[model samples]
Target: MEQNLQYFLIPFLNWEMMLLIWVGVFAGIWVGAIPGLSVTMAASLLISFTFSWDINSALALICGVFVGGVYGGSITAILLNIPGAPAAIATGIEGYPLAQRGEAGKAIGLCTTVSVFASFVGIIVLAVAAPVIANFSLKFAPRDFFLLAVMGILLIGSIGGGDPVKGITAGAIGILISMVGMDPSTGEMRYTFGNIYLMAGISFVTAMIGLFGVSEALTQFRQAGLKSPKQNLDRIIPSWATFVKYLPLSIRSSLLGVFIGALPGTGGDVAALLAYDQAKRSVRNPSRPFGTGAYEGIVAPETANKGAIGGAFIPMLTLGIPGDAVTAIIIGALYIHGLKPGPMLMIETPHLFWMIVSCLSISSIALLVLGLISVKPFAKIIEIPKEIIMPVVIILSVIGTYAIQNSVVDIFYMIGFGIIGYFMRLYGYATGPMVLGLILGPMLDANYRRTMQGAEDQFLPFLQGFVTSPISLFLTLAIVFLVFSQTAVYRRWRGIQ
Candidate 1:
């Protein structure tokens, strides 16, 4: 405890580290609350900025942004019905109700508090349990990874709560988008339309911005001059009684967040959605339905999404496998600082490991303070005019696209993709499928190719594992469930009296 406490306190005394953390926190909020700006883009930008900094300072900045970005999303969710990040989708459901009811301050405040508490809890879990979890995860084979991928696919239900078809279609589209780059197995180009820029496939971050940001901006034009109604900034603090009342949900969601976040390839979005679904199932309240603004709804995803912070760091520290894109970047930062991650990392650089964990814990406290101070200003951004907003968004989109590689073609690509996203939205097709496809396309490509390589053109032995391996069996079942989720039989089964 003494040694751990020392590491925990060390980061606080470093002024350079502190400034970076603050920069990350505020910047994360600014970008993350913008509908199109995802954490991945922000982190990607940080890679260039932090190239010259030492590991600790760089980490402080990145981790602070990561924490703030995850929570910054809830600001937009509460202020507008649109979720800044997919994780905030649940927050919007519960938070928008609070906003509509003229209690925006309390809703934001309570979730902010809950988010911090959940993040701390996740850190504690990571500090205590990462090694055990990593050991178990290491035992997982290719079949297990495939099963896990299937689980990610199944999350479309959570993503498409009201419209299962839209969600599945979105996921399918995301898969296709993911396939845009080179064919890993055959080394062939796909869906590139013969452009040299298409060689890298679509940028997932760019697509996320176009789909969520640009498309959403266009959607706002439909309601020109109509803003999401603003509410009085009520008591910023939830009453102790109210806090106690939702404590159970907060704790449950936090635990759920950590578990899902710790799983490699799954991050806060899935954790928040999973906990949201679980909360909906567990809450037996016929008196107040979820969407109409139950406190439990507010508590569930808010806490869980924040809870994923600690969980995401587990694999990054212990196994060097990033739990998410943000953590993946952090891994790169660590390498730049001359810290290598592997089995010997624990023994070789125990102090750095402890310091990283400690810094994670500190950022949570910092987020709570930062969140409260910024909530009022954040609420004001809701009133910003769209005419001014869309132009700036388009500019940022162009700049962000070009910034990725100083490529002029990417600017054209962003504009063209933005148009595609806009048309897709107008026709009632969700852009989510395309964005998801962008994220997962490479995973499917690489893994499927590797699987084939092992089989050496012989398909029978590989086919045998689909049923025989526990992981493959689980994945196959998940695919079946996902495919049949919209069918009468599955719906009937799920809706059984």
Candidate 2:
């Protein structure tokens, strides 16, 4: 225990490590607030330049970036209706509406508070229950993962706005678009019509930038002369009563995020969406109706995504498995630094584990300070005139789309998606479902195929697996509950309305 204490204090004692962590957090916030500049990309780029740095220093920096980036993604989602990352998509559903109502400052303050609380929750879980959680997560099979994806698909009903039919249609279209690449199992071409770009599959990030950022800009152009909302920056921070009201929800969603993040191949995006759906269903007396600035909606997703930062590190430290893309890059960095990252990693280098926890702890504190300081400025952005801001949004969308791969073709694809999104919005179709579909489509397809192949393509065996495995059975039942909960009968029984 004394040795572990010493390990945890390493970063606190080392001025260089402390400075690097704060710098990384500051840089990560801006980077993550920009579309296409993902935390994963930032970490990967840092690895290239910091190849010669001490492993402790490099890991400290990466840890700070990981924590800060996840929180920063929500900033634009709130003020501009543009999610810097997919994890923040659910945040925009409620946050943007708040911004339109000129409550951006208050909304952001609450988000920052809950995000820090959730980050610590995830860290505590990582410190205490990481090995157990990592081992349990390994019990999840392909069938279970497919069922999880199916559960995610059911969220279209929750996030689909007022039109269920339109939402389903948009989601179906997104799934079709996701199928435009070569099959992973067999090298068979899918929807590619002899086009080289289509063969590589559509990047959801490009589609996201177009559908959210560009589509929002175009929609604003329709009401070009209308003045922007005058944001009220007073009382940015919530009261103790307000924080207490959301405490239970914050704990639940944060725990949910940590567990989901501990699962290999899943990350904050999935956790945030699931938390949003859960909050929509469970929160009885929200500050406002969902999709129009419910405080619960912001609390659930922001906390979940922030908690996911710590959850992501769980499997990486304990089992040598990456919980998300950023951790995967960190794994590579570990290798580059001549350190082995696997089951025996902790035993061999115990200080690395504790030091990371310390770095993340400090980073979360930095986020609290920095995030609150920026709330006023970010809220002022919502007060900008539509004519000026819309064009800037469009320009940023184009640049972000191109940065994905430096391909001009992606720009065209983005523009096309933007136009489609505009038409869909005109017709009352919610674009959230389509983005959700794009995000979960490949997971559903790949996992289902893997499960089927495991059963030798026998339909009976495949079906039986759902009942035979405990994990699969639980997930199947949860999916059933999710679908049933959407029915009017269920809503009536629960008196949800």
Candidate 3:
């Protein structure tokens, strides 16, 4: 216990480590607030530059980036309706509406406060229950992952806005677009159509920038004369009573994030969406309806994604598996530093686990201070004249798209999607479902294919797996309940009206 305490104190006591963490968090927030700059990309870049740095320093910086980047995504989502990362897409649903209603400052203040709380929740779980969660995570099968993806897809109904049919149409189109690359297992070209650019596959990040960032700018152009919403900067932070009122929900969503993040191949994005859906179903008499500036909607997803930051480390530290893409990069860093990651990792380097926990804890503190300070500036961006802001948004979207793999073609694709998104909005189609489909389509396809292959392409045996395995059975039943909950009868029975 003494040794563990010493390990945990290393980051807190070392000034260099502390500074690096703060710097990393500061940089990560900017990177993650940009449309195409992702936490994965930032971590990978850090790995390249920090190749010669001490392992402890390198890990501290990366951990800071990991925590801050996830939180940063919500900044753009609330201010501009463009999520810096997919994890913040659900946040944009409620947050953008709040921005339109001139409550951007208050919404972001609440988001920052709850995000810090959730980060602590995740870290506590990582400290206390990591081994158990790691063991349980290994029980998931391909079919179970497929089921999880399906559950994510079903969220179209919740975030679809007013028209269910249009939402499903947009989602289906996104799934088709996601299929335009080579099949992972078979190496067969899907919808590539002999074009070289399409052969490599469309990046969801590029699509997201175009759909949310560029499209939003174009939509603003249509309402050229309307003044932007006047932000309410006073009373930015919620009172203790307000925070306490949402405490139960914050805890629930944060736990859900940890659990989902621990699942290999899933991450904060899925957790946020799931949490948003759960809040939609369970939070009776919300301040306002979801998709229209409800505080409950903002609270659910922001907390869940922040909680995922801790959850993501659980599988990576305790087992060899990465909980998400950022952790996957950290695993590479571990190998580069001549350390093998797996069950024996903790046994061999006991200090490593504790140091990570300590570093993440510090990162959360940095986020709270920095996040609160920046809320006013971020909210002010929403109030800028559309003539000035819209052009800048377009330019940023282009830069963000091109930064991903340095491809000019992606910029063109983003612009095209922007045009398409503008028209879709004009016709009353929400873009959230489409982006969700893009995010989850590959997961569903790849997992379903792998599961089918495991069953030897036999339909009956494939079906039996859902009932045979305990984990699979539970997921299957949950999916059933989710589907049932969408029905009118179920909604009425639950007093959802």
Regions of candidate 3 where Cα sits further than 4 Å from its true position: none
Q: Quote the positional error of residue 119 for candidate 1 in Å.
A: 1.0
lDDT of 2 by residue, 105-219 (tens): 9999999999999999999999889899999999999999999999889999988988898999999998989888898879899999888889999999999988998888888
Clash pairs, candidate 1, are 170-433, 174-433, 174-436, 174-437, 175-437, 178-437, 178-441
Q: What tens-digit string does per-residue lDDT give for candidate 1 at 1-497?
A: 78767877778888778777877887887777765567877887887988997778878888878888898888877775556677786777677777767677778888888888898889888889988876665655555565555555665654453576776887787788777767766768998888777778777666665666566667778877775566577578777887787888888999889877877877887677667766765665612576667667778988888888888888878888887778888887778778897667777877777887867777787888889998777666555666776677667666656666677876666666667777877776666556555655566656655665666757887677678866577668866765666466755666621
> How many pairs of residues collide in each model?
7, 0, 0
Tens-digit lDDT string for candidate 3 (277-355) = 9999988888897778999999999999999989999999999899999999999999999999999999999899999
Using lDDT as the measure, what is the rank order of every candidate, best first? Answer: 3, 2, 1
Whole-model Cα lDDT per candidate?
Answer: 0.73, 0.91, 0.92
Superposition error at 180 for model 3 (Å): 0.8
TM-score of each: 0.83, 0.99, 0.98
Candidate 1: where are CA atoms >4 Å away?
13-20, 35-54, 80-104, 161-163, 225-228, 280-282, 286-299, 385-402, 405-427, 448-497
What shift in Å separates residue 221 of candidate 3 from its native position after superposition? 0.4
Q: Which 10 consecutive residues of model 3 have the lowest summed lDDT?
A: 215-224
Give candidate 2 misplaced runs (Cα > 4 Å). none
Q: After superposition, how far is residue 179 of candidate 2 from its true place, in Å?
A: 0.6
TM-score of 3: 0.98
